[model samples]
Target: MATSVKNNSLPPSLISNLNQVLLSRQQHTIDHQSTNSSSLPSHSRNVDEPDCSKPLLLITNCEGIDSPGLIFLVQALLSDARFTLHVCAPQSDKSVAGHSLTVQETVAVCLVEMSSATAFEVSGTPVDCVSLALSGALFSWSKPVLVISGINRGSSCGRNMFYSGAVAAAREALICGVPSLCLSFDWKKDVSSESDLKNAADLCLPLISAAVRDIERGKFPESCLLNIEIPSSPLANKGFKLTRQSLWRSPLSWKAVSANRHPAAGQYLSNQQSLGIKLAQLSRDASAAGAARRLNSHRKNVEIESVGIAGKFNGQQTAKKYFRLELLEETEKADDNLDFKAVEDGYVAVTPLSLSSTDQSKIETEVSSWISAALGREQRN
Candidate 1:
């Protein structure tokens, strides 16, 4: 059996150490931001410009185009002159949409006013946004140097990654043969502020720059995308630690409700009524023409009968069933080196992900060396 730990179960000494780190870095960050403000431009160059010198970077998020997380990340990257940026994201939140694409319907894309970077808001999931952008359908370039999905509002650790639109967006890019990164914040309700998001974006700048440089030299790790999770208190985080995906997950529970109490029931009822009204009008037209009147009346009668059946079905107390999903707390033992544990301990966790099963040892070694060099730190054993 695996041991379970709660978020509030941290040792006092560890909490003290994190607080000290935060205090020490606060002044330094302020000074750094001030210095960069004078040299860096407020906005990035337009993506339409034929700037071959700077690598083109494509960014998207599950939180939609106008989210503060995405905005902060764009601001951070714009301040750096190394990459030309483009923004393509969902028009509305699709946080739990997974890797689903809008195959059944036509997806709409609209130009968005983002500072300097060319941007579009798509009427679809994060996967749809990236796929459309990279399909040579939306942008002039088919392949950007790198694709970044997120600065997401919530963590994508453990099994949650499978349900994350942000992670799916990055995975979509990897499928298209481009290196990608998925960034997320371990957001805590009420405890976390918007400034933490900006801090997280700023903190990830060095790692992003390093990844881009390695990518340009064809030295990025093969067959994997990076998923980075920033701790709740971004400024208080212990430095980045490379970690493996954990088995931790919040279990889901379904609560039963009456058909009439279900949210979708009202929409269904409204649509049925509208359909009946349309058919009734058609029946009236047929009667006026004195042709196909019987056929129209029969159709109208069927519609009315269907509506009556629906009403009776909803009125039943025990015949029909409905449910709503709710997440339940569950504990699973996670190792110190796992992504979930690292974030829980106030460290920024970076996990490398591949589409199919691969040699875990080999990938770990490669990622360890790559990130160590990227951050100018000694490699872990």
Candidate 2:
């Protein structure tokens, strides 16, 4: 019930119904993604696949499509005649998130020897999965040409891009001196349709193929990641755009009480509808209390549901609420900021990003310096 019932943009009953349906779909998708697949081939395929000796690409993805979409994605990737698939995905649903490492849990990285793909499940972050795949953990055969993350379930755009594990994985790979890309479909709860997913995959395939080719040719950018947000409709109808990151700050604040304080917690509240609405508002944004109090009229009030400290800007702790980080603006005016615009019928938005300069340049220069030093020693020898 974190949705507004009094909102007239959509009818109150319709909004309520859609919200329930959406939440249910989200939960179902997560649950389905968490379980391991039983449809995989028993043994690894030894067919006309690219030589294991040749360089390949490593793929790391979140857990929305553990079985169905994942399988389809793998099949499509294998359609590339030149690249060998080296994947390390989560065993269950991590959803469309980013860079979360499990320290104390016994998350296994199991070898999944399928027909068209060679993959494993890592009990780690998408970043860790890529690290393991690139390292000697999953594939002991060859170094990857690039790391392709996602084909994620939702439109990981605007501020949502920051929270994406798919994007974070790519960033991590770039930080480790690997070329990386993150692909996501324009998935919105009620706004987007099921056909959108199919369209997104189609749009992503050619761009990714070209990108992979560029990487292989050594023409790819150094220490950069591609955040390709696919449109929700047909490719021709839903045009694509190569875009830059939209720096937007959305702050959030809230307090959580003990579970025992309310006996009917966790489940949907049936009685005392106003109380349910109030609680839902609080759940949506921590700043809702202040926002609610300040608003003289309910004409067009927006709440910032919840917040957490994820990233920092200039050493001050920034809040991440609803997947938006509090960003530092160079300009004093915030109203004229035309940062992110939806691409392709304004139905989808693509927010391309790069890793921090320190993260990118440090490792690469260190490696180059080592090589140069070794060459100097060789001349002496």
Q: After superposition, how far is residue 45 of candidate 1 from its true place, in Å?
A: 12
The stretch of ten residues in a row with the least summed lDDT in candidate 1 is: 305-314
Worst 10 residues of 2 by lDDT: 329-338
Report the lDDT tens digits of candidate 2 across residue range 3-29. 767754877899899999999999998
CA lDDT for candidate 2:
0.58
How does each model score on TM-score?
0.73, 0.56
Best by TM-score: 1
Off by over 4 Å in 2: 1-55, 64-67, 191-195, 236-238, 249-340, 344-351, 357-381
lDDT of 1: 0.85
